[model samples]
Target: MSAESSGGQTPVEYIQHHLTNLSVGEGFWSLNIDTLFFSIGLAVLFGWIAKKVGDSLDPDNPKGMQNVLEVIVEFVDSQVKDSFQGRNPLIGPLALTIFVWIILMNAMDLIPVDLLPWLASLIGIHYLKVVPTTDLSATFGMSFSIFALIMFYNFKVKGPAGFAKMFLFHPFSANNVVVKIILMPFNILMTTIEEIAKPVSMGLRLFGNMFAGELIFILIAILPFWIQWIPGGIWAIFHVVVITLQAFIFMLLTIVYLSIAHQSQDDH
Candidate 1:
């Protein structure tokens, strides 16, 4: 057998190559195919599980998956009700979807980073990134979706005129004509900054955490075999908690953003 077919590449070289994303374009226009596929697949699977659990639930007798799902539903329901004062059927479901979908995506980190890609290479497909959150595009896409939802809720709850008024005079004085004139430009600048910062920060936060976790995993994979197992095992165990917490935090923030957008000025 050839050297290539003998012992094969070192684990470090194998993992480094796999971590690279399959991109289709340049800069911001670029798309990570692996991240997109894994994220969508996990989201669909979780959605199906949620539906099945709901269907299986019986008010008369509930246990196991049904009971766990009911608890999650109630928890999310209470959060939506407490934060948003409006009759929106969409809000509750949307929040639940975000929570479940994000958790499922984050859970992908629990799998061995090199497992699927290594298996794929056996069949001639070499590159695959299993953790979607590590992809900037995936996180940004989620945040952008939340941004759209915020705008929709803003218009739905406040109306065009009310939403416009918020931009003109918010978190500042527009009480007098002179004050309004002075503050209008500043208010617009601040409001614009705030709106832009929300989605960017939301996306970056998730991306940063996941990317760091992935990097650490890569670094650990590169260690000498004698020392590799120790750090790799420890980080993987700790990362299970980190990824889950990050997903939960991201979901909660989305709910909070929508809740804030839906509130009337006086409610603040």
Candidate 2:
């Protein structure tokens, strides 16, 4: 964005505006409209494309979109096979969804930072952040969903009694009953922290990377018009790698976590 687009606002103000969300409601109850809009839109598009590809698959001779999607599906399935244990059919599709959906959300950073916001401005929408992965709510929303799935499969595979036993008795087993009882609290504390760390770290890692990348793009947008392309072009190229790697890491971690959940403590 040029200085002209700032409309008398300072550089800091311009950055702040670019970073702000079109949000509503109060505090935790608030929703980020742009984040939701782009994320849900991309998800629907992914679903439609997958449906079309599935409906039209030809084993005799696959080409074009079929070839491309099969590559992605097969790649995701390979990852699931490597990382997921036991038999949960959902793992394959869940990993694929996480990989591609996050890639779509992260790809929003590749858009010119000012393009969508400026377009929205023409319609009186002053604030818009297009990269949904940069939004904490979106990242954490996804991470927490994975967390729920981990819990579900843990219960499914291990049963509540087994899960409770693993939770309460792991990493501190003792031959003496008294010693085992003494270590239960510490085991519980450690287990809680590990479980919380999975989702918290997952969410923060995605949000931090995308947010920093988007901020750099916004900063590039505010540079002198004649010189903006140098940095913008360079960062955009590097960011393509960053976005794809982040999506892959997120997917891999989800698989690994679920695998752990599906295993007995003895298995671990």
What are the lDDT scores of the predictions, listed in order? Answer: 0.79, 0.90
Best by lDDT: 2
Model 2 TM: 0.96
TM-score of each: 0.88, 0.96
Best candidate according to TM-score: 2
lDDT by residue for model 2 over 103-143, one digit each (tens)? 99999899888889889999999999999999999999999
Worst 10 residues of 1 by lDDT: 1-10
Off by over 4 Å in 1: 1-16
